[model samples]
Target: MSSNDSDSWGAVASSYVQVERLTTPPCQTLVNRVSLLLPLNVPNTIAFDNGCGTGVLSAVLRQQYPRLPLLATDASHGMVNILRRRIEHRKWDEVRTRVVDSRNLEGIQDGSFTHVFSTFMVCLAPEPDKIVGEMQRVMKPGGVLGLAVWGDPQFGPFSTPWEKACRRLVPDYEAPMVMDAKWTFAASVEAGLVEAGFKDVVVWEEDVPWRWDDVEAVSKYYLEGNNPGNVGMIDAFKARGGDVEEVRPIFEGIIKEDCGQKDGSIELHAPATLATARK
Candidate 1:
């Protein structure tokens, strides 16, 4: 990950505390899909949530399955600390949070978990293959692994323009090399689970449209969420004689024009896939 990406999360850590209200609903949608793929009855099962951002997803899981034993870990120490505090407040005795890089699970024992789950963190890594291998290594035989990846939402207003703008600006921008790095599973199958010897691989996609009532909200995500890895792209735009300050306004207008509705919310769509496989 680039400094911009790192800085964005560092900057937003305080604000993202109330994620349920500020962030959109696609998170829950992905979680629901994971829940569906889990075994019918998994009592007393040990689960691991890798790349567990602010711990919001893990916290939500605890709320849904109070008895589910979970170990939540993130690559970001800041995120782990916040999540630890959050889980502590939740009183989830079985929940343990830590900071661990996805590519290496050094301290985790083999076959320590019955199920492993992750969301939206694969593409940023230098090697998702290793991460998936580590995840599989930590799971008990017949244990399930659930992960969600962002699928290309070509039809989405925000995604369409941003992806287009990135190419128009930065010619050398490296998209993920993994087949599904852009959110399909070709790379994941080739570089991930299959390579790691996981069986019964299953993949499904869902499109969730985010409605932002405030233009500032859309601007924030653009300038914040996607901006870090996009500095090169942004600089390219600036070098082309585009007024950098005008970028935000232009994006806001685009959202207002395409996805915005009479209901005072701008619609942004995120298409993603929920993939599962058992070992």
Candidate 2:
């Protein structure tokens, strides 16, 4: 998340698809927050879901506003494929999929969408300012650009253990995280939006729900599990010449020890920011 490059985001997003259960709440909530700024039921209210990893926002919009058309996009082919499969499974005829890097949405023409929303991706972009500019270029004159980022990311209890585990597996390895401190403040987000030529910018905080009902599945995904979209942890381990399966149990132990809760469930505090601006 620190690097302002597509590959870093791809890796981070690739892992996100594997953990959709805990992420769905925030994605849906962000959509709800952004809805207040932009009208969705109008016939001309076409939407763009930028950086739409696995099409979570698309699914939310489709379910809520059945008649609204959506263009869902992500830089990762694997993620787009997953979204394609979801579209196929859900029979969402109003939604289309594209594999486009958000920083350069060259495939799309100017003023193409009335509403553009990206959840959980703006801060991690290598060229966040450029992406905002591209958003401005693609949105209509009175269009709304709504996005969400972790405004002061709160790492889970297992974050320290996970970092230490990475060190144990990969010597002298500095752990790469998806939350960039630069875009973690609401004021920073508002300033960036205003600088990008967006007016009436609004930034507000929201608490994203982070909970895991099953620790075993969480542990498996944390390491080398069956998830093909597991480049975040698995690739980090592999790129460092370490075996992820060997350390799976260690993470499981750590999660159960630190993240375990009294109600027989695990939870983490997640604070986020939702930003909306008019282009």
- Each model's TM-score? 0.81, 0.79
Evaluate model 2: give its lDDT. 0.73
- The residue-by-residue lDDT of candidate 2 on 65-139, one tens digit each, is 988999998777766777898899988989998877788897799999999988876665667777778889999
Q: Kindly list the per-residue Cα lDDT of model 1 for residues 1-279, writing each as its tens digit.
A: 344444455555665643334223545655565567664237757789888878766866776777888899877766777787777776779888776777888799999988788776665455667778889899888888777666642223344554444444455433322223533443544346676888888777777666676777777755665333344445545665655565566666666776778877776766666677888
- The CA lDDT at 8 in model 2 is 42
lDDT of 1: 0.65
**Model 1 lDDT, residue 99, Cα:** 67
Candidate maximizing TM-score: 1
* Ten-residue stretch with the least lDDT total in model 1: 173-182
lDDT on C-alpha atoms for all candidate structures: 0.65, 0.73
